[model samples]
Target chain A: MAEHEKITMAQAFNQALRDAMTADESVLMFGEDVGALGGVFRVTDGLTAEFGGARCFDTPLAESGIMGFAVGLAMNGMRPVVEMQFDAFAYPAFEQIVSHVAKMRNRTRGALSMPITIRIPYAGGIGGVEHHCDSSEAYYAHTPGLTVVAPATVADAYTLMREAIASPDPVVVLEPKKLYWSKDEVDLDEVQPGIGRAVVRREGTDATLIAYGTSVPIALEAADAAAAEGRSLQVVDVRSIVPFDDETVCAAVRSTGRAVVVAEAPGFASVSSEIVARVTERCFHHLAAPVRRVTGFDIPYPPPKLEHLHLPSVDRVLDAVDTLQWDDV
Target chain B: MPSHDFLPSEQPVQLLDQDGRRVEDPKRAFPSDEDLLRAHEALVVGRRINEQAYALVRQGRLAVYPSSYGQEACEVAAALVLDDQDWLFPTYRDVVSIIGRGVDPVETLTLLKGDWHCGYDPTEHRVAPQTTPLATQLIHAVGVAHAATLRGEDTVVMAMCGDGATSEGDFHEALNFAAVFKAPVVFFVQNNEYAISVPLARQTVAPSLAHKAVGYGMPGERVDGNDVAALLSVLGDAVHAARSGAGPSLVEAHTYRMQAHTNADDATRYRQDDEVAAWQGRDPLLRSKAYLTGRELLTDERTAEIAAKAEAVATVMRDGLMQDVEPVPGDLFEHVHATPTPQLREQAAFLADELSREKVS
Candidate 1:
């Protein structure tokens, strides 16, 4: 076992990829700028030099070709972790991810399985231009044959990458760019389980704040603020977005009776919206107030100054929590 | 990344005379007469299936169908190049190719019948669904070839497309990828002169479409698509080269569409009657009959027997089309996703309710 040391979220991702590559010869990485440049966010730093081009390299600037070739490579018994430079830039390859990568096994009646990892640097906190700051995880989560996940901290980043690589299905791992520089203690040597399960970050009795990716930190901050204000707030980190730790969500919402869903994606028809709808239906009898969502506004991710307004902040989460009918008793 | 070395130049290969006589060429040696006779029998079956499909369109059984009325020779010839284990990626016009490859005619109609997906299993038949999105399947075929090579399998992927598909980005990418990786694939471009409405001259600036293969570092050749013997020889050579690890090859089959593109297309608007008459004189089936008569292989009674068998096959297919088939609405949701998501399940349930209400009304 390795000693736990605080490291940035980007470094954790880099270490996770390195650890996984060392353990399994099947793990390979490829994307534009992932080679000598260490990836745009440096999540894949030193990988190309360590593993050589056969195991890690840069592909043509064609997104569809990269994903389509990864599908071929995975079908041929190689686990390829593809980097989609930014979340918004992954649209060109969306068809491949949706049509072929997700559907290959089902189409072939289990003859083929796509154990590919698609790493996306997503969310809108970096002030990166329009194409770089989109939270497109909901579009992928909506697609079947794919598992969607996001890690809000260093420890989860390390564990989730390894878990996603080992799964027998395609996985889309979105790394919130804003949290990439944030540091936390993580055990580098410990192997992690599959990323299909969610984690309860904080315990409380009054209400539950469910969030994933960038919003996890906001929910944590909001929970602390609520605790100080004499309100009990249970915070749940929905690490897996697609298979959606529905069991955890249902249990948390039922116990608390009040829920606030949070996400970096827009509130209109976003992943958070889906969560609220499902929770409302399943936990309808256990409700104290209509489920409120603190999320990005229904507009294109605006400029840097406006992005802070668009994204869900701790203040927004608290505001949503305050709307609950606590005085009804 | 040498500029000139990027693509290999193309050379067209033709072994049959306009009159359908096989030329004496060692490079174009074909199978024995018994093999050709078997192929001829298959061609008859394919023609019957095609005729039935054409009539189905008229009877409102199918949404649309592009008939290969006079291009049966090209379809059958391309399909005959491979064993059942080999793969084929065909376009929408390759109806005869599908039938020649042993697919049931009824299953082929499943696509135009608005059956959500391709009619047959690609892995089971090694024939991908007929690609309606132009040359996208070209790249997929190359990917399959790459997979086969990595697995150390000696299989050839035959990807068929039209002259118009050459204009697509997918075709360019597929050619480049295949050449760079030395993927075991053959690109069969059926140059049917017109791409719906645009003529070949308007499609490319090169003297011959086969010459475009030079850009991809592959051997490109031309063949008379209307001549079954020529098409078989050319495609067979390409397939052999691919299977033997010689790398990719492109075969440009010079053919012409005799019928309207579909029931909806009117070729008379762009093409003159004189042009159509000239090609009609060189009818591939008639030329085959002439050659068979010259070889003392076709008797009046044998010809009548072949015609009668073709008619019977057509009758069977037509009868099948007439029978009422109330398509189950539930089937639409079954294959949309391998395992339907919770959202998809909800959508399916919702649609089912709506459909049931309509039924009651």
Candidate 2:
């Protein structure tokens, strides 16, 4: 057994990049401030020093250029891991992401594969200003030919990052910025489940709370609160959003007969909405009540001071749980 | 060297004037007689391909065709400049250039025919899919060239765009990154006077498109785009410099889109006929033929042979495209990923059931 060490999600991510680069000579790391400055969040700290500048260097401040070239590099047989710095900042590269990075394989009829990983620091908890915090996973999740994953635990963060880099297709890693400093004891060598599989964070049978990325910990907290009130609320972390683990999610919903999808992104026509629709269609007979969604309001991310009012809170999840029609019980 | 050294000359480079008279360029040399003859033949074939594509669009065999009717010089030269190991990144209008790279003419029209996103294998042909979004492929070219440099390969990438594309932000970013990293990329801008209906004046206020490259600290050259001999010589020089590690260069080929943006566009809505007639006097094929005959490099027999070859290619394209394409419903689920998700599998099955039901009806 490998020794377990207490580390933050940021450290886990940094270690993952270092390990992937060390393992594959073709793996490269580049983006704005990813060099000696080690990314704005320092998730890429010490990588440039460990693997010379040629392997881990900083790119010019151009998001579209960074993504566009990453596609080219991937086409030429290099595994490139690019950092988007922040969630909102990735919008400049949206055309490249949707048009080329996401469609290159299908566009060429599988003649070319884009083995590129785009890491975006997403969601809001810390009182950072607007644009610094956004749950932009919905955009990536909606695009085809892209594998989107968000890891809530330290162990999953490391393992998922490694898997994302190793995948032959493009993967979008939505790292929770607010959880960067959250610490957990984890064995670095312990490989978690691969992408496209949901894991149950907390087991129960009364109702299921489905969440991902920054919302997983919040869902767990809400479940703990429910437990004190004699309710057995289950938590299912939907780590992968695109190739959604429909089997696991549907099974969980069927077992509980109720589901409340959770995320920081706005609920209207979002990944949360998609989840609710899928749960409704697949578990229509098993469902006890209408599937509910506890998500951010359908508005632009709020100012830092009022973000608490905009983001989904434990009270909101419990309130949604109450609406799931416990009258039958 | 100072950045000013990279500025384009006051006059665009020219080997043959519009009258097919040889103009002396102290810094540039004419291509060998053999290369010139080959380039002329390619120009002839490229123009024929454009004509046939127009006919296909009228016949409803193709959804639309962006004819590179008058830009044959830039199209053929860009393709002829690269070695077999090199790669060419082309735009939607660069089908002539794509075919000149030895890609099958029928496969080149696949996207326009609406049969597939791309009809041929990019890796096998060393040509990228015809990119529709302007200036995006430039960055891809830079990245590929940079990768080749890292792997210690002598591959140079020729990225083709237009005058209007140079106004895009990705264009500037690509040039800046290529120069900073010293990637082996040549950005060939075919300044065909119009991007759809928008004229060059509406695109940029810069003195010239090639002059924009000086800001990125790379050498820029402007060539007479209608003069195939000039395009071949100038692009050949740029490619050679990149292959030898002189870093990236930007070459702006001065030309005109003699045809409308596409068969769907009405040229009379944007410009006067006189403007088109003026450029017709500078036709690339006419100039190439005149120069070849003047230099005694072209014989009647050679011209007939070239014309026959062009006709054969056009016939093949017509025959291949006239055949109905078989659509596979299951192919939609394939190639989305190496392994389809459970959701994708379920969706695929549902689609299959629906298709079968329709068949019964």
Candidate 3:
């Protein structure tokens, strides 16, 4: 294996882009400010310089155009990666993303496959407020023809991106904006576990904590706090939201018989809601207590100063975990 | 505006006048008599299919059909101009165009019959699914054409939309993208005057829909939609320019909707019969046939033979549509993705078990 190096999630994402572009001549990147500015998060930094403007260039500030253009590019056998700038900024292009990009392959009866990846810096916690930070994983996850995923670690940031690019279906890669600078030691030559599979990042014997994207770190922090109290907890990171790794989640929840799901999106019709429902459905008999969810409020994302109150903080997650019954313990 | 003057005399381009008289433009050369006869034959078939599909919809054998009865010349010419390597992005109203492109009529009606997501396989044919949403395919066409250009494929893509669709943001985006990137694509807008109940003037205030293309920094031209020779020449030129890397162009064909939007609409509420009668004089099928007769390409026997061929094709399509299909309940989840999700998988299994138990009982 190659040398192990510590890098931030942003760096890992940039490396993945470089790797993808270098590997395939048909791969190209286009979006607002993705070119010379290297994206607002700088996740696409240095790509334009290395790949040349033809392969990596800026486009007019139109999200629908970017998405529609990407869909067409993929249909014509080119791999197109689009950066939607921010979670909320992508709403303008939601029609193209959902109606055309997501349904193209299915509508064409599998004759047309769009191998396109859309990268949106998502979720609140960076204090950007409004359109800058919003969690939209559920919208895409609910979509059938799309593959939705988010990276919680630097290694996953690099690996999941390449996997998304290589996949034959349209993939929505929700980059955890709050964790963009989160760093970890990653082996450059490690055998990738692949996308669409969940992993047990931490193990415990008590309640199982289910989360994806930004919630993974929060869930992990809550687990650590639980460990201090001598209440063991397991952390399950559902990297892929739509075709979620049901086996890992069901197994963990079934074993513990208690669970708490975490997310940054609203509690209403949210991804966290789906996780809790599934856990309850599969582990109903084994459950010691009802599964709880710690998520953003149903209201629109509040102002920056109020974001902490609106987001599911570690304390909020631990509170949900605390609700699990200890009678069996 | 870069010295390409196809919009002369403030009238749409036409090689043969509506009266079947020669009115050729010196600047634009005409196609050969052989080519004209071939176009006439294709238009005849296209118009016959249009008529038969309407009848099927009326008889309740088919659910809905968008007849391109008045715009057959533009529809047939659009398909005839493109090389098979090129792609076509058609809207719901462009079924006649798909049939003109050699896609099976029965397959093209599957979507209208509410049978499947798309009637024909996009890979098997160069035509994309006939999208119902206006102007959405325009952007998709630009995207696919741009990708082809990037890969150095000598292919052009065409997207068909109506006059009202020019008002959509996607149309603006498609033209602008094509112009900026020099994408090998063409935007074909058949200005048939109405979008369901909405008229063209209500959609845009531009002097002409072709003017919208000039604003996008691309060449735009208007053609007599009823004249097969004019449509063939204009569309062929645009496709050639795009394939040769002259970037994208917009061609607006002036035509009319001879039938209601679909079998459901009542056109009498919007326009008078006199207006419809005025357009009938410029019928695309009749004008082309008259032009062919003048050149002695269409004899009385040959006309009868063409009518028989068209009737046979329609009969086959009708019989195919009348056949009942065996439904697999699992197909509900099949095209949803390359692989169904865990939730869908569980539901599909549950359905399969319930059906098996019902059969056993």
lDDT of 2 by residue, A1-329 (tens): 56677999999999999999999999999999999999999999999899999999999999999999899999899999999999999999999999999998888879999999999999998898979888988888889889999999998999999999999999999999989999999988766888988999999999999999999999999999999999999999999897798889999999999999999899888999999988898899999899998999999999999999989899999999999888865
After superposing candidate 1 on the true structure, give the runs of residues whose Cα lies further than 4 Å from its correct spot.
Answer: A1-30, A33-57, A71-81, A102-116, A153-169, A180-197, A284-286, A303-306, A325-329, B1-12, B22-39, B197-208, B264-277, B297-361
Off by over 4 Å in 3: A1-3, A327-329, B1-9
lDDT of each: 0.80, 0.93, 0.86
Candidate 2 lDDT tens digits, B232-262: 8899999999999999999999999999999
Clashing pairs in 2: none
- What are the per-model DockQ values? 0.27, 0.84, 0.74
Chain A TM-score compared with the true chain A, each model in order:
0.96, 0.98, 0.97
Q: Which one wins by TM-score: 1 or 3?
A: 3
Ranking by TM-score: 2, 3, 1
In Å, residue A82's CA in model 3 sits off its true spot by 1.2
Candidate chain B TM-scores, in order: 0.92, 0.99, 0.96
Looking at model 3, how many pairs of residues clash? 0
Q: Which clashing pairs does model 3 show?
A: none
- Per-residue lDDT tens digits for candidate 1, residues A112-176, read 67889999999988887767799998799888778889988788898888888877788899999
> Comparing to the true complex, what docking class would candidate 3 get?
medium
- Compose the digit string of candidate 3's lDDT tens values, residues B262-301: 9889999999899999998999877878778887889999
Identify the candidate with maximal lDDT. Answer: 2
Complex DockQ, candidate 3 = 0.74
